[model samples]
Target: MRNFIILFKKEMKEGARSGKWVWLPIVLMVIGISQPLTNFYMPQILEMAGNLPEGAVIEIPMPSGEEVLIGTLSQYGTIGTLLFVLAMMNVISHERQTGALAFVMMRPVSAFQYMASKYVAQLCILLISLAASYILTWYYTNILFDHVAWTLMLASLAVYSLWIVFLVAVTLFVGTLLRSSGGIAGVSVVFLSVISLLTTLLPKYMEWSPGNLRAEASNILLEGEWGSSATLVSLSTLALSVLFFGLAVYMFKKFERFGE
Candidate 1:
C-alpha cells in the first residue's frame, strides 16, 4: 500500500510535468461549453452563414438541455477518447524504453503495485476532467435550455465514468503489451471501435459489454429512467476493467526482463 501511494504520487507529478493536468480538462471543458452555446445560437449561426435570401425566415428548433448534454457526451466519446488514448499510450512503453521501469523495479515494488498506481493516477485525472466538463455542460445547458434533472445527470455521469475508466485500463493493457506508442494508440482505438460496432449491431446480446455504457448514460438523460440492465452492465464493465489491469500487471512483469 505504501509503495502504491508513492508510485501514484510519482505518476501524478509526471502528469503535471507533461501539462496533461491543464490541457486535458481545458479541452474537455471547451468541448462541453461549445455544445450548448452552439445549440442555443444555431439559428443565428445558420442565418449568418447560410446566405439565404433577404428577409427569408429560418426556423431552427432549439434542443432541450438533455439533448445538448448528450451531444456533448458524444464529442467525448470520439475526440475525448482519442485524446486520452494518445496521452496514455506511452505510459508503460516510454518507461521501459528509458529504463525508468528498471529503476523502479530495482526497489521492492511489485508489478501489481506499480500498475495499480499508474492506473489510479490516470483515473484521477480522467475523473477530474470529466467532472469539470460535465459540470460546465450542465450549467450551460440549464441556462440555454430546459433544466435537466440533477439526479439523472449525476447517475449518467457515474455510468459514463465507468466507461472511461474501462478505456483507460485498456490503454494500460496495450501499453504494457506493445513497444510502440503509435501501435498502442492504434490498437486501442481499433479495439474500442470494434466494441462499439458490436454493441450497436447487437445491443441485446452485448448488453453486458462496456460499449453499452455510453448509450446507457445518454438514455438516462433522454428518458430519465434507468434501464433494468444498468446494474449488470456496470458490474460487467467494472470487472472487465479490473481484469485488464491485472493483465497489464502480468504483461509488465513478463516484459520487464526484456527491458524493451
Candidate 2:
C-alpha cells in the first residue's frame, strides 16, 4: 500500500510535467461553455433559416436550458472519451522507453503496483473531467432555465459517468498492451467504432450494452425520468469497466519490465 501511494504520487507528478493534466479540464470547460451558448442561440438560428412555405407550419419546441446543458454534455462527452484515450495512450509506453519503469521496478515496487497506480491516476483524471463538466452543465442550465431538477440532473450525470469509466478502462488496457501511443489510440478508436457498429446493427443487445448507456443517459436527461432498463444498462457498463480494467492489470504484469 505504501509502495502504491509512492508510485501514485510519482505518476501524478509525471502527469503534471507532461501537461496531460491540463487537457481534460480544458476540454471539459470548452464543452461546458459551448452547451449554453448553443442552446441560447439555436432558436434564433432556426428562425433565420425561415418558416415553412404556403399553408405549411412547423412548430419546433425550444430546448430548455436543461436540455441545452444535457445536449452539451451528451454531444461532447461522447467525443471527449477519445481525448482521454489519446491523452493516456502513452502512460506505460513512455515509462518503458525512458527507463523510468526500470528504476522504479529496481525498488520495492512490484509490477502490479506500478500498473494499478497508472490505472488509478487515469481514473482520477477521468472522474475529475466528467464531474467538472457535469457540475458546470448544471450551473449554466440553472442560469438560463431558472427552474431545474438538481437531483435528477446530477443523478443522470452520475449514471452517464460509467460510460466514461468503461472507455478509460479499455484505453488503459490498450495502452498497457500496445507498444506505441499511436497504436494504442488507433486500436481504441477501431474497437470503439466496431462496438458502436455492432450495437446499432444488432439492436437486440441494446438493452444491456455499454454503447447504449450514453444515449440512454441522454434520453433520461431529456425526459427527466429514470427507466429501469436504463438502470440495467448502467449496471452492464459498470461491469464491463471492472472487467476491462482487470484485464489491463493482467496485461501489465505480462509485459517485460524495462531492463528485465
Candidate 3:
C-alpha cells in the first residue's frame, strides 16, 4: 500500500512535468465544444462559405442536445482516441529506455504494485480529462440546444470511461511486451482498429466487444435506460481490463527476471 501510493505520486508528478495535466483536457475541450458550436451555426457557416443566391437560404435543422453530445463523442472516437494512444505510448517505454524501470525494480516493489501504480495514475488523468471535456460540452449543449438530463449525461460518461479503461490496460500490456514507443502506439492503434472493424462487420458476434462501448454510451444518452447489452458490455470491458493488466504484470515480471 505504501509503495503503491509512493509510485502513484511519482507517476502523477511525471505526468505533471510532461504537461499531460494541461494539454490533453484543453485539447479535448476544444474538440467537445466544437460539436455544439458547429451544429448550432451550420446555416451561418454555410452562408459565409458558399456563393449561393441572395434569396436562397440553406436550412439545417439544429441537432438536439443528445445528438450534439453524440457528435462530440464521435470526435472522441477518432481524434481523441489517437491523442490518448499517443499520450500513453511512451509512458512505459521512456522508463525502460532510461533504465528508470530497472532502477525501480531493484527496490522492494513488486510487479503488480509497479504496474498498478502506472495503471491507476494514467487512468485517473485520462478519465478526468475526458469528464471535463464532456461536461463542458454538455453545458454548451444545454445552452445552444435542448437540455440533456444530468442522469443520462453522467451515465453515458461512466459507460464511456470503461472504454478508456480497456484502452489503458491494452496500452500497458503492449508497453510491457514491446520496447519501442512507436511499436507500442502502432500495435495498440492497429489492435483497436481491428476490433472496431470486427465489431462493425460482425455485430452479432462482437456485441460484447469493448469497441462497442461508444455506441452503448450513445444509446444511454439517447434512450436513458440500461439494457442487457449495456450491462454485458460493461462486464466484458471490466473483465478485459483485468485480464490485460494481469498480462502486463506477468510480462513485466519476465522482463525483470531477464534483466537479472
**TM per candidate:** 0.96, 0.86, 0.97
Instruction: Using TM-score, rank the candidates from best to worst.
Output: 3, 1, 2
Q: What is the C-alpha RMSD of each candidate to the true structure, in Å?
A: 1.8, 3.4, 1.2
Which residue pairs of candidate 2 clash? none
The residue-level lDDT of candidate 2 at 220 comes to: 75
* Every candidate's lDDT: 0.89, 0.76, 0.93
Model 1, position 31, has a per-residue lDDT of 89
Writing each residue's lDDT as its tens digit, candidate 3 over 168-223 gives: 99999999989899999999999988988999999999999998999999999988
Off by more than 4 A, model 1: 257-260
| Ten contiguous residues minimizing lDDT sum, candidate 3 | 251-260
Residues 197-222, candidate 2: write the lDDT tens digits: 77788888666887776677677776
Per-residue alpha-carbon lDDT of candidate 1 for residues 120-223, written as tens digits (9 for 90 to 100): 99999988999999998999899889999889889999999998889999999998888998999999999998998999999879989998888889999988
Worst 10 residues of 1 by lDDT: 251-260
Please give the distance, in angstroms, between residue 198's alpha carbon in candidate 3 and its true position after superposition: 0.6
